[model samples]
Target: MKVAGRCGEGSEGMVRVARGPRSAAMPHLVRGMHRVLLALTACGVVAFAGPARADELTGTLKKIHDDGVVVLGVREASIPFSYFDGKRTVGYSQAIAMQIVDEIRKTLGMTQLRVHEITVTSSNRTPMLLNNQIDLECGSTTHTVERENVAAFSDSFFQYAVRMITRKNSGITDFRDLAGKPVVTTAGTSDERLLRSLNTEKQLNMRIMSARDHQEAFSAMKDGRAVAFVMDEPIVYGFKATDPHPDDFIVTGTPLGYEVYACMFRKGDESFRALVNRVIVRSQTSGDAERLYRQWFTQPIPPRGINVNFPLSEQNRALFAHPNDHALD
Candidate 1:
């Protein structure tokens, strides 16, 4: 399957809950009313339905309304997408999450809506979201069929490919070159799954290691713990560029897979998902997302002035031009 993030909005399956009580099951109630309305409309008896009222708010929105707080799942280090830039969480995804928060404030008319950032790793992010410990995650998470089976996702904002970073003298040109070599990827990421599958399917017998995060994976390669660091192309490039000896490493290899990234949340929060998608769709169509891409990928970024220099790909251009939640997988 390709890296499957969408450019448009989509709601797929079941969700966990928010950190608080969602006593107001407005979505279910609305669906029940919708059934009746559809039946009536078929008979030409009822033709109109109005918007939900304040008290009818449900799911994350309802939780936010009641609690006045929006919990955002943030990555401590995903680089350029989402990471702790020393003092705070900042990145392309972080900016998008903030936009969602702004819209949430407007939607609820709550001028004092507080944003709570919780650091999440690749493994725990989903569980935290499912358990209602966090509200939504906007990071470098790949939108996949497996993930959609449990959670909901916003429109696709970014697409990427699986690649690897290796030392220049390592002479690793592509996937085949890494055969029988020690390779590392972040634990719980799609890249790890892809690498393992490659090892098994091709019988490469590659010694695979899993780090907790991107930084750790990079460190593995830097410290000679692994011959290669595998991850998304841009992320590996980000790390390579930022390293003290930028020329010592290179991001190479035929992509193992293609995937898209999106904001994720509980499975059935229609209102909240809509709000998040609006922000994303707005950014794509308005050229805001592209600018952010240039800021993070092509330009120099924080703590150091390293320029990743990854240009936008044709697939992403198509995604931005025609936004949709179509999973590539």
Candidate 2:
């Protein structure tokens, strides 16, 4: 699983977590691999049931497949991943999506496979995939056990660690230090779930508030409605760069948990999921993953702010080395 190329180096070491919520025990990993194999076998056994005519689709993916197009659903808010690029959407995830679609067409021997962008809200993302409105979602989504029930996720292309963001003078040093203090997090996000679980399980006694989006959450921290905002480290760094007063905010707290950011598709569509996973593996093996990351995350911000090069943590490096090859069945 060793990838070729230098593979962007320069970060402190961190432990890699299982992308899916399974035991690190060898037996579980083996079982998971078996399940994926079985699922893919099932997909192979099924008849295509597609059109008799050349390049025509007769089933669920008719509109896009027949038209030789790949529809991607993305969040307009998530930065450094999928965000507005002028009138179009672009980012690391977007670049990965483009490569995936291109590979899909080539691998499947299709003459042309166009890419169509679809905007999706947090709540509608899963539903959109279930209904086949989007073939893939190339946004920053955490791969958690609950989410796995409805959708299949590709091997995580990126790793993120949870952290807290607050004003430099807020005096919040860690999760336990926020007793009775309000923290703003996006609604229906892993950040909200993690914080609430901490309060209950660890008896942290923190007051939590939810915002409709990341912008609102950050605004709450800036306006004093909330003492801090909780999210992954990279996300906080991305937003911190765009802050009107960059020195005003500070990122604090020990890493809570590791998150595996990956592309997602419907649970039952093994062929489609495998197609996306193949692209991810190729990207990592070819040094494209690290290159794309530097382009978006390390490069200088446009209009304002300085270049903030995010160092590659050891955990991510290991993920690139021994990725769960059976991410998609």
Best candidate, lDDT: 1
Model 2 lowest lDDT segment of ten: 6-15
Clash statistics: count for each candidate: 12, 0
Residue 129 CA displacement from its true place in model 1, Å: 0.3
**Candidate 2 lDDT, 45-78, residue by residue in tens:** 2245222344453332444556677789977757
TM-score between model 1 and native: 0.83
TM-score of each: 0.83, 0.78
lDDT of 2: 0.72
> Tens digits of per-residue lDDT for model 1 on 1-329?
11122222342111122244444755888855655554443222443423335797999989878888999999987888898878899888898899889878867878788999999999899999999999999998888888899899888999888999999999899999888889999999888998999999999999999998889889999999999999989888888777789999988999998999999999978878767876776678667889988998888788676788889999998888667676666
Q: List the residue pairs that clash in candidate 2.
A: none
In candidate 2, how many Å is residue 145 off?
1.7
